[model samples]
Target chain A: MSLTILGCHSATPRTSAHPTSQYLEINNKRFLIDCGEGTQVQLRKYKIKFSNINHIFISHLHGDHFFGLIGLISTFGLLNRKNDLHIYAPTGLKEIIQLQLKTSNSWPQFDIIYHELKNDQSELIFDDNKVEVYTVPLTHRVYTNGFLFKEKIGERKLNINAIKENPEIEICDYQNLKNGKDFVTKNGTIIENKELTFDPNKPLSYAFCSDTVYKPEIATIIKNVDLLYHESTFLKDRQEIAATTKHSTAEEAGKIAKKANSKQLILGHFSSRYTNLDLFKQEAETVFDNVVLAKEGKIITVDNKTFATELTINQ
Target chain B: MSLTILGCHSATPRTSAHPTSQYLEINNKRFLIDCGEGTQVQLRKYKIKFSNINHIFISHLHGDHFFGLIGLISTFGLLNRKNDLHIYAPTGLKEIIQLQLKTSNSWPQFDIIYHELKNDQSELIFDDNKVEVYTVPLTHRVYTNGFLFKEKIGERKLNINAIKENPEIEICDYQNLKNGKDFVTKNGTIIENKELTFDPNKPLSYAFCSDTVYKPEIATIIKNVDLLYHESTFLKDRQEIAATTKHSTAEEAGKIAKKANSKQLILGHFSSRYTNLDLFKQEAETVFDNVVLAKEGKIITVDNKTFATELTINQ
Candidate 1:
């Protein structure tokens, strides 16, 4: 799985910075989150295939979080998208999108499926063979929820050396061994699955916490994730304002990551008042060791282990 | 009057080019026309005073024409603007905007007045002391209208030398001369206003046409205007495609300007397929003597004459 940062700035769009928008690719499926203004252009700059975006998740209705959504949907109509598009968002998003389409007299030629979120507790939103998505209720000025994408554990790997030594073992027994079951011989002799097979493949997960105040309860829902993306709308100096606005500071985001025991932490949605982002990195690094600032066009891989690299803009 | 090109590209937004959006300042009031995506950022880049914009005119409901409108309005709320905003657009725009606000659970503190355009005939939309705005019925795939902004006639100049030579003229007759009327002195001397004083400053006018086919009837409404901004979405090579889409090519735009006897022509909304805009300028220049490409951030002054200059994009 790879996460692409299309935009990260908070509040408004600037020449050098953008508002919140991101693209995550898991199991070859592209998912867009929090499409702020200019997100469509950012998608083009990052060379993301628009048709590949099958699902979209909106955290809340703040302009910085979902302003570009209507435009992107309109662009899809212009591009003649045919596949069904699924959107998971707050209850009112469907009506908003439909109204724009009606006013423009430019309805999409494809199917648009909307899933409205209402639960205040963690609930499964989507599940496929490879990935499952759950919502984490968050504290904010408005009703908001975070998304947790977890990869399902795969079948165990066979120990070739052990199989070679036990040539008498039936092929069915080997299959059972690969399924993490103990191997049984014809004479009632049994061998532990750990002795015959390697460990099961470890699943990777990523949690996206967008536009929320610092809440310790989130750690329980997103604990021990491979990567965590948290909105850090302000620096440590503006903690008071951050709390008042139901936004998190960089230090607070770092603390969340540390408490969640996440493997890596990516901070984004920076306030426009910040001219220099180095201070955010400095402040976050103090609380968490594996912390990185989310830059536009930056891509991070979430697998058994997490790694990050910058993708060329306009690629 | 000054025109600031916030965005000038056809179709979708890219890293290098933007969709259609422009800011024109006529008299002292700021008017925004056709706010494409990312227009707010462009306004910031150009250092445009967003607060000064009290009026917005949308040509059509196409995404490239007004996708950024909701975002701009939302930003205005975020900035805590108390002044009321006026929008002149097609009938359904109000429903679209209101629906978004309802879904987002965010209502603006200021009033949003809407003037719905339901007639195909040309009608005055805004008439203030200094400027008058009228809609020019247009032919397109969608319900679209062009806008004509004309400065009201100012008080005539005194022509001090001529006035000094005719001191015997009645003081009341001088007021008539200022109104471009013939002056009759109390001593039975008649003087034409043209000879006694310069004619009242000829009001300057600008016509904006976008997403429209080459319709000659528009000349009747926007005849002999000082400047004409016509959409040239394609070059002559793709004239057939342009016609099919109800759009004009550079040559067609120039022809319209030449037929209307416009003093200057500005060609914009170029398709992304053409990277080198020199071809568009060359094509337009072949048909009209004074033709310039509408570049993003270029400011055009339309007074007695039209003058254009490039504004710095990033301050």
Candidate 2:
């Protein structure tokens, strides 16, 4: 799985900063998360294929989280998209989006399905052959929920040398072996599948959290993830303000990352007052060694391991 | 009066091109016209102060023309704006915007008044002390209207030399001269105001037309305006496509300007397919001499006498 950061700023728009939006590629399927304003333009700047975005996950109705959604939907209509598009968002998003279409009298040519999220507890939202998505209830001023995308463990890789040596093994038996199932050979000999094939690679996972306060209880839901993206809207000095506004500071995000035992922590949703993002990384690094600041057009991979790359900003 | 091009492109988002949006400064007051997606960012990029904009005129319900409006209004609420905002648009816009706010559960801190345009005839939408705005009925796939911004004729300028020659006139009498009224002295001497004050400066006007077909009837309402902005969604080669879609080609826009006898013509909203913008200018220049392409961030000034300054595109 690969995660691409379309934008990762907070609050108001600045010359160099953007609001929150991310693109995750898992098993060749693309998922867009939290489309802030100007996200469509950023998508074009990063050369992201718009048609590839089959699903959009909006954490909340905050303007910074999903303001760009309507524009993206409209653009899809203008582009004459034919493929069905799915949106998983808070309950109210459907009414908001549908009203715009109704008033404008310009509905998309494609089918747009909305899966309204109403529960506060963790629940499976989507489960495909390759990935499973669950919600992480978050504390915010408004109804909000973070999403956890976990890749499903696939079949084990067969040892070619071991397989070739067992010529008596039927081709159908190889399927059981690849599935890590013990098999009985034609000679009545028991073959251990573990010995015939290597153990299946560990499934990687990523969790996205934003526009919420620092809640320690979240650790249970996002524990030991490959990558964790947390919103750091303020610095440690503004902890009181963060509490009052239901936001998180850099230090608080780091604490969450530490408690969750995540492999790496990515900090984003910075306050517009912050001119230099180095402070966000520096502050988070104090608590977590593996910390990276989220920048516009940064891509992260989540296959077996997590990695990140910055895309060019010129576009 | 000054016209600022906030965004000008057709259909999808591009790095170098933007959707349709414009800012017009008439009589020193700002008015936004056709706020497309990302318009607020463009407004910031051009250093146009948002606080001055009390009125917004949406040309049509097309997403390209008005998608950014809700976001802009939300941003105003975020910024804690106290000024009332007036929006004049097609009949359904009020409900669409209100529904979005209702679903989001975030009401604007400021009052938002709406004036829905229901008639397909010319009607005065706004009249302030210094300017008057009238809607020009347009032809389009959807309900659309063009706007004519005309600066009210100002007080006549007094020729100081001519005024000094007649010193017997009281300062109060000078007010009548400025109003183009003749003054009679106590000695029964009559002096023509025309000899004292220069002729009232001609009121300059600007007309904005977009997302409309090639309709010659528009020329009647926008006749002899100082500046005219017309959408050119396609080139001459795609004239048939433009007609079928209720859009106009560069040549068609130029013809409208020629027929209206506008002082200057600005052609924009080019289709994304056209990589070279010179084709629009070339096609328009064939019919109108003073033709300019409306690039993002381009600014034009319209004085009471004439329109001037073809601005180079800002980075």
Candidate 3:
């Protein structure tokens, strides 16, 4: 799975700093999360294909989180996009979008299926053969949610050398071998599935939490995730402001990452007041050593076996 | 008067190309017109002070015209602005903005006064001591109105030398003399007003029109404008598409500019399909000689006598 940080700043989009938005690619599925203002432009700057993005997930209804939704939806219409767009956001998003479209009298030709989330508990929101997405309920100024993207366990791989040695293991028998079934020879000899097939690559998981307070209970739901993206809107020095605004400091985010036992922690949603991002990484490192600061255009790639081997940390 | 074109593209915002948005500084008044997506960032890019902009004029409800408004307003709240914001838009805009703010549950400290427009004729919308703004109604796919910004006639200046020649012109009579009144000597000798004071610098006017069809009647209302910004969404080769989409071609924009007797014409709202922006200027020049194609960072400053002397044309 690969994650592209389109924008990582909090509150406002400045000259080069963008608000919250991310593009994730997992199991051949593309997902856009938290579209802040100028997200469509960020997508263009990063060269992400607009048509390939079929699903959009919004963490909250804050302007910095989902204000760009209408513009993106409108652009898709002007491009003559044929695919149906699926939006997973808060309960009031649909009504607001519909009101804008009605006011303008320019509705998109494509279908927009909205999956409004009103549930207050962690639950499965999306499921397919390749992946599963679940909500991580968050505590914020308004109703909020964090998403957990988990890749499903894939089929076993065939051991080519082992299968080649057994002439009775025909091409048709390869399917059963991949399904982890034992191979039975025509002469009544049986071969173990482990000997005929290799184990599948380990599945990976990423947890995205933003615009939320320091909720320690979140660790239980996103435990052992390969990558965890947590909002660090402030540093260790502004703990009081962090609490008042329902935002977490870098130190708090690191504590949560450490408690969750995540393989890697990606800190983002920085307040524009801070110019030295390395301070966030340093503060996070005090609690958790495996921490990386998120920056616009930074890419983080994670695998179950290799872990976060390819990461563009913003120092 | 100075006009900054933040974005001038017709439809979707692309790389280095923005949608419709402009910043106008007339008589020390800051006004934002047509805030498309990424406009706030563009304003920041151009170093325009956001806090000084008290009035915002939205042409229409189309995404390309006003999608950036919410984000900018939200940013203003985040910055803790104390000045009230005045937005002049369609009737439904108030409801839509209110819905988003209500959903987010983060209301700004300052109040937003709405001057929703439903007029179909040239009626005054904003009247201050220094400037006046009127709606220039246009035919489009939806209810849209262009804005005409005019600098009101300023107080006449007193010729210091003429005042020195007449000791009877006391300091207390300066206000009357600045009001275009003649100086009367204590000996009952009346002096002509023109001889005492030179005429004030000619008042400047600008007419903004966009996302409209080829409507020649627009010239009657915007006659003799100092600067006219007309939409040139397409070239003459795509006149059929322009007509069908209710947009104007460069040639049409030139014709309108020529017929209106505008001193300068700024051709903008360009389609993204065109790479050579000079072709638009060329097409416009066939009917109007003083034509400039709009670029993202283009600044067109107009004066009464100097005309379009400080212009940064794309080509």
User: What C-alpha lDDT do the candidate models reach, one value each?
Assistant: 0.86, 0.86, 0.90
Q: Itemize residue pairs with steric clashes in candidate 3.
A: none
- Compute the lDDT for candidate 3: 0.90
Can you write out model 1's per-residue Cα lDDT over B288-312, one digit (the tens) per residue? 9888888787887665633443334
The DockQ of each candidate is 0.67, 0.68, 0.85
**Prediction RMSDs, each to the true structure:** 3.5, 2.0, 1.7
lDDT tens readout by residue for model 2, A43-100: 8888888989889999998787887888899889988999999999999889888878
Q: What's the candidate order when arranged by decreasing lDDT?
A: 3, 2, 1
Residue B155, candidate 3: Cα error in Å is 1.5
The most accurate candidate by TM-score is 3
Docking class of 1: medium
| lDDT (tens digit, per residue) of candidate 3 on B234-273 | 9989999998989999999999999999988999999988
Residue B134 error for model 3, in Å? 0.8
Against the hidden reference, what TM-scores do the models get?
Answer: 0.89, 0.96, 0.97
- Please give the range of 10 consecutive residues that has the lowest summed lDDT in model 1 chain A: A306-315
Summarize candidate 1's per-residue lDDT along A1-315 as a digit string, tens digits: 889898888877877688889899876557898899889888887788898888999998887888888888888888899999999998888888887788667789998999999889989999988889999898887789999988887678888888788777777666777778887677888878888877765787889998899998999999998889998989979999998989998899999999999988899988877889888888999999988888988888755533443333432
